[model samples]
Target: MIFCTYTSLVSVTHTTVVDAPILEVYSSLYQKYGTKLTCPCTNIAIAQRDFITLIPTFHQVCYSDFVKKSWLSYLNAASDKYLSSDFRSQGGLLFQILASFCRLSQDTIKNSLNKFYSTRFISNDVLDEDLLKNQSRSHIETYKSTTAREFVNSFNNIRDAISGNQLLSGFLTNFDFKPSKYSSEPQAYLVSYVSTVYNMPGRCNCDDTPSCIFPASINDNNTGHVILVVPGLYTGCLLVEAMRQSNLQCLYNQTCLNEIKKHIRSSVSFNSTALSSFVPSRYNASTDINQLLTELMVESWIENISHASYYNRCQPAHCVYTIVGKNNAIYIITALLSLLGGLCKVLYFLTLIVVKIIRRRRGKIVSIKFLVGMSEIYSILTL
Candidate 1:
């Protein structure tokens, strides 16, 4: 009789909360301070610096206006749904602004710098020192003129591009600053919350005490749910769920069953001694693919835990240390210590009661004997 087992696919989900509002946290220093700002996003700092240095005319003429307009655009973009999907738009605005600068740099290198540098040393055989000096000076002057013209042209192109691009236009529009509903008073308390999901598959064995019970029919599907609550992220908690699959076919398709089978086969073939002994005797090659796939998926999910990066829009400096009035660890520790002090007082009182009882017993013996003797003497004198 051919026996088969089926397993369902599992689904997982997670959410993370941060202490600061998404908008203020992710914005670049340049967007916040303009010409007065230095780039805080290190990944794009070089491009930003190039843009600043090359576009001298823009800085002189339209820099202030650009900063104001971009800041407003950023606020509007925050209200859009797309913000949530892309880590609250970190470096998004800077990317848009720098796009034009990149394009200009590419053009300059291609059309002018490359041509000039290629030909500058082409006639290196000239022996005349005076001629070489004059020619070098001329080349340098020509290079400067070419770059100057390119810079002005690039600025114009960007300005014109801004007028037509809807996203850019919106970003460049001058609008008044209004705080988002998500925004809190800078001093308000905030907490970060994060969530993630994982899946685990059942194992099959044909032994009397098999790891998993095999159903009579291949159509039977079993499912299980697990919830894990863990403390994480600066006084916050994380919840993870491992969900069981209900449909065998659905699980197989979602997790790429065939790929997993091929990989397992390849691994076993390459490392026969190491893996051959571990293969289960009851494991039906065909029926066990579902189980193997589930195991693989669960392992991959677990491995992803170390690689996960939480979406945080807050500035690295202020966000790391900022806490609401008193919800922080320092206050919590103080409260715990106060409770411990009260417990110590109770313990001290119990010790005092025990000591007094022992002392009273000893004193009572002596006092009672003395009292009896005094009573006898008084009776004798009266008789």
Candidate 2:
């Protein structure tokens, strides 16, 4: 009975063969067990690149001719008298900064990926689509936002460091500290004013006055040559401010390009094609460099999650579940019947033993009484 009960009441594990696509099986498993069940992976050290893909797009300027040696060389060789002459050196510097920003953005994203694969993922551990997607998004946004802030702060520091009023520029071009008659003003005053406006944005300090900047003439008009002023370019107190405040729409306008080409001695080498907004890009032609810098100059990025690969890596042999024996009607009835048969057999054997003992005792007592009666009769006859 004890053996029968033990066999009947024991719990069992059931395995159900999954007969669906791998992705479907994975989804079903997640739905049933969530993260609680462990699916051991055949390839435990799965590379993140196998399951995730990332592609980044950088600022258009980084891809444009402005940063190319051919274009800068052409600018240098072209007539210095043209309005866009300053573009030869200043444009180079600006785009260099842009290229640097793009590199840092790429590096930061790479590090984030490394960190993700190194720390976040456990290959054999069960994973769900939502969990993976959310994790990817979190890492991307965290790195992007953090790097963007840092990139912008770096520019701000550069901006503040070169102000015409306070920093190196101020020392070079001193302001008139005291009131003086216009006639009595020293030649230094004229030199200071001209130098202030002539250097970069030349007009005002961006920190003290938001509207202090204006488009610098393409050519130095102070050189007594006729200044050629481009339509959309400006020079601010700092090169960064100039990029932020100025619009690049002129670079996208055909007429503007034509005007710039006409001023240059050679039109053949000049980049006559306007900036294209049609090319799949995150930023438009009018988006200024300030916004570009703040965004770390990334035009776009691609994210892909491969559930198939994940499933393949975590290929489960079968689904296993345990069923407890309690409250099961069939098991209960079978166990009870087995216990009843065992108990009846035991009771019958006990009854047989008890009957044998009673029969033996009764026989012995009868015999003893018979012997005593005979002896008494024999004594009476002798007397």
Candidate 3:
């Protein structure tokens, strides 16, 4: 009987932004070792991790937008194919993308196999063999043999789970905040103040004065605030006073474009000037963001597969050899028949020997009886 251990999926709540240049490095590594990166489950896990890392960096930038749009388009186009057939297909684009982004460690893959299953499920001993040649085909069946369907099923499950999770909303919230300052000052003056304070460099030798030099008359004005955003299961946003003080206080607040406009209006002298001239803080409310998040979550589902003790138990063998036939029932029946035949032959030979001995003894007994009767008759005639 096969024994498997139950292992929980790895919890990945924290995320960090990985820049494009660094991702390119990982992509290069994947290309170099694509053949060695076997195991669909492990590949999926790594892909998920990569998506989790990349999704947070999505912004209004052209590259980010391109990635988001391209991926979504690919998904839509491949929807029918993905649903109908094995996911490892699609010109191997998904696999390539996943492989390019996630670098799988050999050790981690080796450790993820189930120990008991690994020892007994010996298909073929091709551990040192090159996998590149085998994986060249687009179809999953051409490569994975018995495991092709399983891999496809796992991929689907992950995709479904990610879609169900709705990860984007989980990580994001509506940006809302109260106005910090209101004034009747000129637009240029207000814009200058906001820009100057926002772009101020760190102080070298700090004094009791605030880092941002404000006008003396600005005592009546409200000091601006700094917003801190960090990535996590639930992304956290903290607002802190912009002014430097001995004890810093953080105000729990949400970011809103309207609040920013109000703050700019309060600080500006003109009432009619629109804040549209300045770039508004970009909020990610796009459906593309949801798609990206779902994709990432789907990819991350592979993490559970990679870490699962079942998959980790043993590396799948590429070949199998046996002295007996492949069919267990046939081999067992043949073996039993051979054993029974041998036993029957041995018994038949023993029986033949016993019959010969018994026949020889009976002949001897008859001869002895005849000789005794003849001797007795001769003695009686002589008398």
Candidate 4:
């Protein structure tokens, strides 16, 4: 399960148009939460702990938006200069972006796996095999084969549990807050924030028109539901502004545009239905902010867990080292020592056997007392 922990701005904006004023909600949030709500990485030490703990799950992890953005910027720069970027072509671009960015972070990618997952879950043998791989793709896939798929499958079960009518009943009883406690507003401005650090080719702009040309088969009904989830209020406004700034007025030829409109209408219809399911509650911005924080925290936790698991499986360099790091180093030394010790023992035994055979060949009467005395002497010499 890809647990995305984007800024809470995405969720807040994605709702249908609310009956209450938008500023009211914003005011409530700032008053109650304000800057107090920051990324959980506020404390460097805690962040490190979280990083170490979650390293095993993400084979291909990107810790900072800065790194992913840098790669994206480089790809775009190459494209603008008509130069062969790290990704030679459109296909290459997608693969590189996914390999480099995606879920796994750079810091985690750099460290040894054994250190992250702990020795209990991994061993020396596995670490050696993992570090042997050169490319990021192999590392990512290996991790998935080991970790991601299983965790996602389990998360699916949790999601399924919350899907049916049993969700509200159980949620209300167990949790401190409920979605129903919010304002009785019928509409939410539904927005969806796609990851901004996109390195895909042919993705020059996010204009509604450019979206029409995307190669992914667009369901005629699905086209209109393209809710752009921006990272922040400023970003959202910038997105719309960029659409206007870019002379990309003609969305994917006229035919694609028509299809896109159809998709948008269908999406609106779907959102209307989805929005209707939950009972509306009285609006209290502070309460809503709290709820949003809760949702973000849960998402961050899940993403961290799933990503760490994937890393362990992916063995993206650092992950493999985390496992066998100290133990593997020690194991190699131990093996050498054992081999040497065994060799000495074997040599001592061979020496004794040779001495006895020589005495026998000399026709000497090898009495039991003589043999016993010889054996004792050999043992002392060997020790």
**Highest lDDT: which candidate?**
2
Per-residue CA lDDT of model 1 for 1-383, tens digit only, reads 01111111222232222333343433332244333322122121111111111211111111222224443354234333332211112223432333333344445544654455344232311112344346555655566566656555544464445323311113211111343345356654454321111111244221111112212111111232212111110000000000011112221232332322222212112111111223223322233222322221111110111100111211222222121232345545565677678879998999999899989998999999999999999999999
Tell me model 2's lDDT, rounded to 2 decimals.
0.60
Largest TM-score belongs to which candidate? 2
Report lDDT (CA) for all predictions: 0.31, 0.60, 0.29, 0.31
lDDT (tens digit, per residue) of candidate 2 on 287-345: 77678777767788777877677667666654433333344567667778887889899
Q: Which stretches of candidate 2 lie over 4 Å from their true place?
A: 1-36, 40-50, 79-124, 161-203, 206-212, 219-232, 266-268, 307-337, 353-383
TM-score of each: 0.20, 0.63, 0.26, 0.17
Candidate order by decreasing lDDT = 2, 4, 1, 3
Give the alpha carbon lDDT tens digit for every residue of 163-273 in model 3: 344222111111222355556664332221111121223432111222222111101122423321111101111010111110101101123322322323121122122
Query: To one decimal, what is the Cα RMSD in angstroms of model 2 from the true structure?
Result: 7.1
Residue-wise C-alpha lDDT for candidate 4, range 203-239, written one tens digit per residue: 4332222111122222222353423311111111112
Instruction: Tell me model 4's lDDT, rounded to 2 decimals.
Output: 0.31
Model 3 backbone overlap count: 22
Candidate 1 accuracy as TM-score? 0.20
Which consecutive 10 residues in model 3 have the weakest lDDT in total?
243-252
**What is the full ranking by TM-score, best candidate first?**
2, 3, 1, 4
